[model samples]
Target: MSVPISRLHVSHDAPLLRHVSEHASRTDWCYMHADVASAYHPCFSERLLQQMLQTQERIRRNLAADPDPKAGIHHLVLASDSDVFNLGGDLQLFSRLIRGGQRGRLLEYAQLCVEVAFNLHQLYDDRVHSIAVVEGDALGGGFEAALCCHTIIAEEGAGMGFPEVLFDLFPGMGAYTFLTRRVAPVVAERMMLDARVYPVEELLRMGVVDMVVPRGEGRQAARELIRRNQRIGNALRAMNTVRQACNPVTLDELLKVTNEWVDAAMRLNDRGLKTMERLVRAQQRRAQAAAPALTLV
Candidate 1:
């Protein structure tokens, strides 16, 4: 039986959750667009994280029940509805939690983030592949999220980097692990410490971004890649399996790093918190002004 894409129930109507929609032409492809309420500083809020967990669980159940990988979702693509893919962690929330000395809450948030990243890195199942379509700025945790995908297709002018170092912190959630797996550790360290956004082309040259498409064609490029993979999927999947077997990123590693992140976050001083607050204000201003371009901090 050919399972209809509409029957998968991946589409959601939640206001702050990702707006999922079935690809009209590709029955095996699922699209989840980040439709966050904080469009200016679109970070992974608690609500968004919970929704993502639910959606991934649903997909896992669906895939487990279906014997044929081709019948259901074989590809999951994460994109953004706004101009910026994501501005990274919720700085406003972080500042509040840090000031209140809420280490547990910080850990909880970091855990949720790592869990999502791990699931994406695992692709929910061995049969499915995950992709990220970056059309705009993907900074800090946003960049880390993109790195979790098996394939990252960025559009021209799209920016990616880790700006966490700006406020005396590092992108702790899977940034180091993912980047090391994709590139050299030295390169990854440089990127994290640089605190500057790199154009998609630069990342592509560094072999971080898998493909670069013309502006406004990221989705099309992903679709085309899927079409190509349909023919050699088995081989590609086997290769992915081999790659994982050779160099794996475990949930334990992510969790441990997240713990370290929480500890570091708790140690943020008055100066660091002030920097975070300034960034938060900038995000708010960008939101109010409805800026189309993101100048990554």
Candidate 2:
């Protein structure tokens, strides 16, 4: 069940927090939050992906039917939980799938991830701009998910990285695809392979972060950015279109790399699996601790 902004309501099974903020008759912002405290910890679960896809389609249709070029689903901001933005793919799910030799299930999960990321990346073309307001941690696929947005507005002191290399696997999602867009290929390599969480400032300097606001101001910063964009929305949208056209990262490209991720995950030996298992426990613990502050409603 998807929420209709014109007639707003949250589905009983919707994984994320959905809220619509009215700015004016001209613009409406739909904020879909990452609101999960399970092992997924807002990981790209199948449920979350399906709900988000349905929401996106609904917003697109609403906007398309409007007469104003900038009318309908003008902006999409990916908000986060009170703390961590996301910890990455569901490590526990991966462990189970790999241990059970369910390679197909694992690949299907990766495909779902790709579909969400690729769809968000494609939204810039529809006059629907995507921004990720990262307030806390965004690691591995978490970082990749942020990169999918047209703009990433992060809070100062927030951490972001790809720690897949720690377990002998690589972040095969859109990490490289998106990172290289703002920085050099070599620099992108360092961030992924180092597996060390980098400070927001470092990423800002490296050009990965479009804007870094003071801590606790991520959502406000995102809104300010949106307001500024709305002033010259047409120009911004056109430039975004040109930028995307010049260096397009297609769904095919992401799918190819994600499949490679599946292969690497499948080949993980005992030591690597142990490392992954450790992360799974850590993620669950983190989620449990953050539970009091979380609510899907």
Candidate with top lDDT is 1
lDDT of 1 by residue, 149-265 (tens): 889999999899998888999999999999998889999999989998999899999999999999999988988888887777777667767877899778888888888989998
**What's the TM-score of each model vs. the native?**
0.88, 0.88
Off by over 4 Å in 2: 1-14, 21-40, 70-73, 124-126, 293-297
Cα RMSD (Å) per model?
5.8, 4.8
Error of 2 at 46 (Å): 2.2
Give all candidates' CA lDDT scores: 0.77, 0.75
Give me candidate 1's TM-score against the actual structure. Answer: 0.88
Report clashes for each candidate as comma-separated counts. Answer: 0, 0
Q: Where in model 1 is the C-alpha error above 4 Å?
A: 1-13, 19-40, 69-73, 291-297
Q: Write the per-residue lDDT of candidate 2 for residues 1-297, one digit (tens) a residue.
A: 112222223356745756564547234343434454443365655666567666677666766676766543367777765477777887888889999999988887787777777766775355767889888888888898899888898888899999888789999878888889889999998888999998888888888988999998888887777778777777767876787688977877888888898999999998988999998788778778767657543
